[model samples]
Target: MSIVTDNPFLRLSGAVQAEGIDLGVAAHYGNPMIEQRHLLAGTAIVDLSHRGVLSVSGPDRLIWLNSVATQRLDRLEPGESAETLLLDGTGRIEHDIRVLDDGTTTWLLVEAGELPGLHAWLDSMRFMLRVEVADRTAEFATIGSMAADPAAESASVRLAAAAPNGLPLVWHDPWAVVTRGGWQYAAPEGHPAADWRWSEVLVPREELVVLVARVESADSGVAGVLALEALRIAAWRPRRATEVDQKTIPHELDWLRSAVHLDKGCYRGQETVAKVHNLGHPPRRLVMLHLDGSDTVLPLHGDEVFAEKTRPEAEAGWRVVGAVTSAALHHELGPIALAVIKRAVPVSVPLEVHSHGEVVAASQVVVVPPGAGAAADVPRLPRLGVRGL
Candidate 1:
């Protein structure tokens, strides 16, 4: 009963559905609605229906979107999408979106369940442009692909996958242009060049309930958030709000290459990004922490990380060099976490994740480029949690 795209090959075989994973903590995850690991292992799809989709149209669509977003939209043609970002005046991330170009209309696909916030942000910034923005989450079902074939070739409602050349290629006109990840294409909705020109994903909003039922019956279940987290962490990808907190800036989290266009003109937060890259030093560096013990309870999103031998009293563990922003129990890697650590800490030193009192053993995994710690004073530390706080 699960819904598959109109590919006859996929339809002939039994319907394969996504399964959801159980994220250890409640607040850190969205819904236990999918099993994300399966998506990474092979070809799997997730019902991203919970995500939000928006449309921007009007004569000023290209000009306005180009001016406001972090990335350039003027270079894209019909049937293309790019991972773009929206930053506050300080260059800290405000929102991240996927920009889809359907030849005529521009689409913005945002995180599911985050439409209201994204919409509000867009509205607040709206002034005098021919652009018109509308929430289209209710109008279409959004699905994610981890297929081996390029995402564009898959039988999707529309294609927003990257081309071999890394271009944000689009395949159809989007009522809501959908970027796979990032923010960038928040344009005015009215230009003839940004108008809908191809066939769109045409599911009516009223049938969502039935579609859910069909989707459930076909695939065993959607991949849960845990699997997705594992996949994302492995990919070294950064997320908004969750990964970039009040303490985070674009350069520290690697957003400059993926989301920010350094060569582009000024926007909100441009100065911060520029200064940090050129002059100021980022306080902390983003790293992947691999937990050692199977019994260890994975740290929560904001749980403190400490150097065990540094201190031994309450609030005395080196004052916590960093904290876990997101974590997952990797089936293959045991417990794992994404942490933001101070650049002064040793890269290979054993560390402990302090979940109140419970200590989890962790080792630093080199994911991003070398930082101040690459040549720091790192002793061959003992097992994680060798010293208590």
Candidate 2:
């Protein structure tokens, strides 16, 4: 069922319903390029109410959350925000959460589809802890924007100004920096997300209508999911639904840059995480694809990506190596996408994406490099019986 079935945003003319989360809003409000510019200029309001929110309260909230999540939150200050992940027993990412603490309650922002399961898991893990979990989705909605606006000095000020009801709790994205205890796989200086000044604010669900009206009345730009997705892909951001597969680990998506705390104490999949970072490479790597826009057939999610095989023993001229996770037509960059492929796929090779009996040419821009792990450079111990030279 779509979460926006009764959302007031549907009243906007030209609104289109997307599959997931029922993102029923004007995809562009008539000019997508303008909307993109608004986002970059910090003048856009993005409707992200499709996401879910959960509240954790009580004395043990912080400790209990820090124990289970990948990010360190034991010392999280009130109104401060962080990103974390919930991995399965094998270190595969199961849930990605944006966390915010407001002193009394901890707010967890998660994908709508994963909400029920994540809430249940947190409930089950609270065996003896004083933490109390409650679903805040019905009462709260999320609004996203870039933090680059010079007028608003802080997230609190911006959110408060936008919400007439009162100050809404905000969660600023931690992707811009390498948090303490986290490791960054991407180059520090040139990462696409380095300049991404993004933040999401939680507002009373009933206030969404008022917020939208204010934005439109002020001539402040408004963008939908399509615009946000394009900017995200262009910034090389990996979202859970697009970048993660069943076998995915944080290392595979370069999630260590912000989400994983390498030195954190034991969690569900910490051993596998440590082993992979110290001694092994992720089996797959994430890559950005600049799709050829001349053909007009953009590949969709799950479209098979193939590479031209050079060896004579190859059965076909091409071999299927990966699949497109997200594809978007950027207002400035045209058609672009993000894909996860076998780590062995040569970065030099021009890739092909097969969708609907059409082949779309794609060129790779490495995101997670082929050699993605063994970053710690742990020294190998000498043989037990051998003498040191």
Per-residue lDDT of model 1, residues 1-389, tens digit only: 12223321123223343332211211112332234444553334444444567778777777777777777776767766465677777676777777876656777776653567778777776688788888876555454444433234444222243222333433232222323333221122431123222222323344434444544465323343456666566544676746777656766665554566667766777777667665555677778888867565768888988875443455444347888988876656667788888866766567888784687778887544444212223466679868855
Give me the runs in candidate 1 sitting further than 4 Å from their true place: 1-37, 112-114, 149-221, 308-318, 369-389
TM for every model, in the order presented, reads 0.70, 0.91
Clashing pairs in 2: none
Clashes (backbone N, CA, C under 3 Å), per candidate, total 62, 0
Name the 10 consecutive residues with the lowest summed lDDT in model 1: 20-29
By lDDT, who's the top model here? 2
Q: What is the lDDT of residue 305 in candidate 2?
A: 98
